[model samples]
Target: MKISEIKEILKGRMLCGEDRMDAVIVAGGAADLMEDVLAAAAKGCVLLTGVTTDHVIRTSKIVGVETIVIVRGKNPPKEFIEMAKSFEIPLMVTEYSLFVACGRLYMNGIRGLDGSW
Candidate 1:
C-alpha cells in the first residue's frame, strides 16, 4: 500500500515528510518496544505505535521503516519530527488506538512483517 492510502485509512495527519506520501509500504507493524520493533525486521513497513520519543524515530531509521504513525492522538516532539525529516521518513498521527490503527491497515490488505494471515 501507498503511504497516502495508509494515511486515508488511519485518518492521520502528516507531521512531516509529506513528499514521501508516495512511498510503498509492503507491511505494517505495531509496537512500543523498540527491541521488538527491531526484531520484527520491518523494512519497508509502516510502523504504528503510541511511543513518540526520539528513540522511536532513530530506531525506525535503523530498521528502515517506511513511515511512523503515532497513535492515540499523541504528537511527536519537534526533535523527533526533525530527525524523521532528515531520514526522509514520513511521520503521522492518528486519533485511534494502536490496535485499531493496525486493524484498519490489516483490513485494508496490509500484512504483518512475519507474513501472518
Candidate 2:
C-alpha cells in the first residue's frame, strides 16, 4: 500500500518526510522490540511501532523500511524527528494501537513480511 493510503487508513498525521507519501509499502508488521522488527519486517515495509527511538530509525534504515507509524497517538521527541529526516524515513503518528494499526493495514491488503498476515 502507499504511505498516503496507510496514513488515511490509520487516520495518521505526518510527522516527517511528507514527500514520501507516494512511496509504497511492500510488507508490514507491528513490533515494539527492535529485534522482532528486524526479524519480522524487510525492505519497503510499513512498521507499526509503539517505541519511538533513534534505534528504531537506524534499524529501519538498515532494513530499508519505508515508513514508521508511531502507534497509540504517541509523539516522538524532536531528536527522533531530526534523525528520521536525516534518514529520509517517513514518520506518522496514529491514534490506533499497534494491533489495530496492523489489522487495518492487513484488511486493506497489505501483507506481512512473509507475505501473509
Candidate 3:
C-alpha cells in the first residue's frame, strides 16, 4: 500500500517528507523496540511505533523503512522530525494506538515482512 493510503486508513497527519506520501510500502511492522525493527522489518516497509526518538529515525534509515507512523497521537520532537527529513524518511502520526494502527494496515492488505500477519 502507499503511504498516503496509510494516512487515510489511520487518520494520520504527516509530519515530514510530504513528497514521500506517494511512496509505496511493501509491508508493515509495529514495535517500540529498535532491536525488533532491525531484526524484523523489511526494506520499504512502514514502521508503527509509540516511541518517538531520534534513535527511531536512525533505525528506520538503517532498516530502509519507507515510513514511520507514530501511534497514540504522540508528536515527536522537532529534532526527530528534522533528522527524519534529513534522512529522507517520511514520518506520520495517528490517533490510533499501535495495535489499532497495525491492525488497520493489516486489514487494508499491508502484511508482515514475510508476507504473513
Candidate 4:
C-alpha cells in the first residue's frame, strides 16, 4: 500500500514529507537500532521506529528508506526533522504501538517485496 493509505488507515500525523506520501512502500522494518536499519532495510522502504534521535535520519538516508513512521507517540527531535527535510525523507508520527501498526498494515495487504534488499 501507499504511504498515504497507511496514514489514513492509522490516522497518523504527518510530521514531515507529506509531499511524498504517495510513495510506494512494498516493505517495512521496525527497529530502534540505526545500525540494523542501515544493514537490513531495503531501498525505498518505510522505516518504523519509536526512536526520536537524529541518527534515525542518517540511517534512513544511508539505507535509502524514503519514509519514517515514529510509533508509540514519540515525537522526533527538531534536528531530526530538519535532517529529514534535507534528506527528502517523509516523517510521520503515530500513536499506535509498533506491533499494532505493523499488524494493521499487514492485515490491510501491505507485503514486503521479495529479495528487495
Which regions in candidate 3 have their CA more than 4 angstroms from the true location? 115-117
Q: What is the number of residue pairs that collide in model 2?
A: 0
Please, what are the lDDT tens digits per residue for candidate 3 over residues 80-101?
8999999999999999998888
User: In model 3, where is the ten-residue run with the lowest total lDDT?
Assistant: 108-117
Model 2 over residues 2-112: C-alpha lDDT tens digits?
999999999999999899899988889888889987787788888889998899999999889999999999979999999999999999999998888888998999988
Model 4 CA RMSD to the hidden true structure, in angstroms: 2.0
Return the TM-score for each candidate structure: 0.96, 0.96, 0.96, 0.90
Clash count, one per candidate: 0, 0, 0, 0
The per-model lDDT (C-alpha) reads: 0.90, 0.90, 0.91, 0.83
- State in Å the error of residue 55, model 2: 0.8
Go through the candidates in order and give the C-alpha RMSD of each one to the true structure: 1.0, 1.1, 1.1, 2.0
Against the hidden true structure, what lDDT does model 1 obtain? 0.90
Candidate 3, TM-score vs. the true structure?
Answer: 0.96
Q: Which window of 10 residues has the lowest lDDT sum in candidate 2?
A: 108-117
Candidate 4 per-residue lDDT, tens place, 1-117, comes to: 788998986779987888998898878778888888877788878788889888888888888887999999887778988889999999898899999887887778765544532
Worst 10 residues of 1 by lDDT: 108-117
